[model samples]
Target: MKIQNKKTCIAVLILVTIEQVIKIVINNNFLDKKFPILPGFLYFEPMFNRDYSWFNSMFQLGVSKWIHIVFGAIMIILVYLFYQYLNYQFGTIKIVNIMYAFIFSGAMCSLIDKIFWNGSLDYILVNGFFTFDLKDVYINIFSGLIILSVLLKNKVLNQIDDNIVKDFTKYILRKL
Candidate 1:
């Protein structure tokens, strides 16, 4: 791998490790305990979310664990493919690589949560909004980075074409 790719991989591993370590500490010591951070706005209340997502729990979907695993696996693969596509199109843009690292690390951590922990060990609670963890923060950072990239580098967005879909299809076929 190239130096940039190796760096990105290392970043992903470090982020995933940090997230997993935090979850481990919370699970062992702080599960279900509430520690007020902002009193009414934010707090640390560890929660194990068994459902696949907030949408599933909110709608009472009762999605199976196996399904969650499969879906998570597919998402990880798609994220990787998209990352590859971006790299192929842009030739090692540092910001895109960083975005991929954050997003990929978050997705991997989420998959680990579902597969091993049996759910996400969310410890940060935003009162009246949602409960989340480091993985969620990584994803949110990736989202913000992508938005900023688009706003600052509109030419990159305009330059993208349908080749991404075609290349993705070719890649899948080759793998299959």
Candidate 2:
């Protein structure tokens, strides 16, 4: 692996390790206990969910817990494949690599929870919205970062291409 790749791996490992540690603590200490935070907007409570964060309604679509485990495993593999693809195709972009690391690490964290524990360990509760764990937070934020990095990359590339076209046009006009 290149230096950037190594750094990305290390960063992901550190983040995953931290997330798991926090999850273990929450699981052991505060399972199903709610501690209010930010009045009503946020709260800390450890709970388990067998389904993916965004799949509450679809979870009842005849998907069993064993199937969820299988899905989690498949997701982990897909995340790894996507990261490898990005590395091979766009190795020059460090931010993209880092974002991929975040995404993979987050997915791995959830997979670990799904396989070893009862379900995905969720704690952070948002009033009138949803509940999530650190792993979920990691996945959500890093996924957003991945999208942002791609958009920024495209914008930068477009600007550079536009500048090149303008410069060529100026050169042609001067020659004429």
Candidate 3:
């Protein structure tokens, strides 16, 4: 299960590196201009969402200018927990190594923006959701893949009945 595969490792490193570079550029060039990729649809508008934006959705939370920090804290905590579980469960699996890289980089990217800019990037817009950047995309995709992997693994294994799985469960139950 150890990932000694040079090709896969290098590719994932390249992806994480690229994501960091994009984040740097976006943070720097934010005030320059809003690059619209598609009229009335998608545009690269670099700005912070501020803690106020999310808080305004439901609760008053005091002032309109300041949004609640609860959302940000929750997101950061969730990302951290996800990282811990993934590392513990599949640290040696290379196919999952890519997913891990994506999650780590994306979470870091958002954390950076939130810390300094008070929000994450909103680069591409369509309706309510913004593409933000590739890092954000990586976060979503990798999270989905992780969930899918767990679901698929369980579903495939559940095909066996208790009698059929007796051999496998013997050692597992013994460990219990």
Put down candidate 3 lDDT per residue, 23-106, tens digits, no spaces.
Answer: 578777665577767777777776655543434423645443322344545665555454444444334455456666677556
lDDT per residue as tens, model 1, 1-176: 23349889999999999999998888888786888999999999888899967678788899988888899899998888777766766778777788889999989998998899998888888999889999999999999987997888756666777786897788667656
Best by TM-score: 1
**TM-score of each model, paired residue for residue:** 0.90, 0.76, 0.53
The 0-to-1 C-alpha lDDT of every candidate, in the order given, reads 0.85, 0.69, 0.56
Best by lDDT: 1
lDDT tens string, model 2, 6-62?
788888889899988988787777776788898779988667776644574345664
Alpha-carbon RMSD, candidate 1: 2.2
Shift in Å, residue 162, candidate 1: 4.3
Off by over 4 Å in 3: 1-16, 52-91, 147-176
* Pairs of residues at least 3 apart in sequence or in different chains that clash in candidate 1: none
- Give the Å shift of residue 90 in candidate 3: 6.3
Worst lDDT run of 10 residues, candidate 2, spans 155-164
**Poorly placed runs, candidate 1 (over 4 Å):** 1-4, 174-176
